[model samples]
Target: MGILDGKNILVAGVTMHTSIGYKVAELAQQEGATVIVSNFGRAMSLTGRVIKRLDPVPALIELDVTDDEHLAGLADTLREHVDHLDGVVHSIAFANPETALGGRFLQTSWPDVGQAVHVSAYSLVALAMACRPLLGRGSSIVGMTFDATVSWPFYDWMGVAKAALESANRYLARYLGPDGVRSNLISAGPIDTLAKKAIPGTEEFNRVWGERAPLGWSTTDSVPAAKGVLSLLSDYFPATTGEIIHVDGGLHATGS
Candidate 1:
């Protein structure tokens, strides 16, 4: 039997066929979850093309995480599918283009950092809470993150936001645990996603991933990270929470 048979998953941030969100939704379905995807305004058309890529098209929901209207509307939208959610995969992130792409940390303004943190880090908490009424026992909420151990070139405000994301995972786990809800983050290595456009030194991250990762690295395949996301979405991680599992081909463990 599939690990998530009859379960419903809400995957946010699918923009294109090459998107990591696309890969996660694809694998979640393969693992037997009833997947519902989410996309924003201008990106809505792109999501339709991505849905066609799925073997059996999953339902699509409109969600722009930063919009209060979208947040309030989510529960109603979810009602069209199942009454509750088994899991949520948050692949959403962003930064003011000007604040990223090698922008100096000192040069970034609070408005830009606020936006970065709101959309990327704080949304995880919002996602869990907004779905709380619908998520009963055994329901999981998983988000994506980078190492956040140290800063990377061109990462700028996004890096600071990821640190907040890491911290938020712990807080969510503690607060949500009593009710059987779980929160976790997948610290994936640098993958070639639209989000990566913010990182100024892209070539450096790619080179580091290939050299430091003991298992070797290829940014082409997001399947490994997709699997990690699915693992947390399933009952397999029953006792796991407030954790940041690395899916970076051992890059985080390498010395020197």
Candidate 2:
């Protein structure tokens, strides 16, 4: 039997077939869970195309993380497809090119930083709150994060944004814990996705990770990280919440 058999899940941030979010949705279904997807604006069309790739193509919901109306109406909209969610996968994050690459951390504007944090960090809270009505006992919320404990070359303000996301993950766990809702993050090693392509110096980042990580690393393979997400979303992590599980090939524990 599949680990997630009979569970209902909402997966957000799928923009391409290579997207981690897309892989989550693909695997969730393969594991016998029903999946619903969400994307926004121009990405909506892209997600629609990617949805065609899934075995039982799921429904797509509109979710512009920055839009108050969208966040406010999220649960209600999701209700149209699935009555409730047993798990929520938040594989969403973004930063303006200037805030992410170009080594402009010192000169990065507040507006850019604000945009990054809002979408990449605070959106976690927003998503949790909107999906609150659907999440209940034994429900899980899993998100993706880059290792934010240390600054990486060219990551810049986006690094700051990821740190905020890590902090937010903890807070969400505390607030949602009473209701039995669990929140966690997977700090994955660099994987080749459409989003990673936008980063300026990912090649060197990948090379360094491969060299330094004890288990080695594969930028083209997302299955291992995707499996990590599935584990958290399943009943396997019953007592775990507000935790950052690093699926970085043991890189986070390394000194060099």
Which structure among the candidates has the greatest TM-score? Answer: 2
Q: Name the top lDDT candidate.
A: 2
RMSD of each: 1.1, 0.9
TM-score of 1: 0.97
In the range 83-138, model 2's lDDT, one tens digit per residue, is 98999999888888855465878888888888989999999999889899999899
Which digits, one per residue and each the tens of the lDDT, describe model 1 over residues 1-256?
Answer: 7888889999988887767789988888887888899988878888987799798988888888878888887888899987999998889888877664475788887888898899999998887777788898899999999999987877878888999999999999999999999999999887887767546777788999887899987887788888899899999989999999999999899886
Worst 10 residues of 2 by lDDT: 96-105
Residue 205's C-alpha lDDT in candidate 1? 89
